[model samples]
Target: MQLGAEDTKAIITRMKRAHGHLGSVIRMLEEGAECEDALTQLAAVNKAISRSGYALVATGLQHCMAEGGPDSVDAKKLEKLFLSLA
Candidate 1:
């Protein structure tokens, strides 16, 4: 199922933030920033990306349920997708 506008926008915004974080990480590495600081920023980037992925999967699951409840094949697939991220 296609994502609703709000979900799409939210996921895109999160991804954009993650993208910026990743760029910062690269710049930090180039500048030989402290290892701990770079690692902390990298962790933030990872968390942001993970949150965006979860949001996307949640939206898919929500749409699948609305269309036909959780017993549907699509819902099962979405469940698997959600679990894979764990």
Candidate 2:
């Protein structure tokens, strides 16, 4: 789904930060950093990515509803999309 800046600025920023954090996580693994530290960062990156997915789904749903009205939304599809994130 196409996202406008207004609808996705925070989400985009979060994903970008998570992208950087993932790189760090990879580097930590490559350098054999402490397991606890690496795992902590990795977990944070994972949660950030999941949150981004949820936010994107929310934006898409809102856009669909606003543009096409509530009747145009397919509940089954929305549920599937949300479940995929889970």
Top-TM-score candidate index: 2
**TM-score (C-alpha, index-matched) for candidate 1:** 0.84
Once fitted onto the true fold, the runs of candidate 2 whose alpha carbons sit more than 4 angstroms away are: none
lDDT string, candidate 1, 1-86, tens digits: 67778769989998998999899999999999999999999999999999989988877777777887767546467668888888
Per-model TM against the reference: 0.84, 0.89
Candidate 2 residue-wise lDDT, 1-86, digit = tens: 57788999989999999999999999999998999999999999999999999999999999998888999789999999999998
**In candidate 1, which residue pairs clash?**
none
Backbone clashes in model 2, listed as residue pairs:
none
Positional deviation of residue 35's Cα in model 2 after best superposition, in angstroms: 1.1
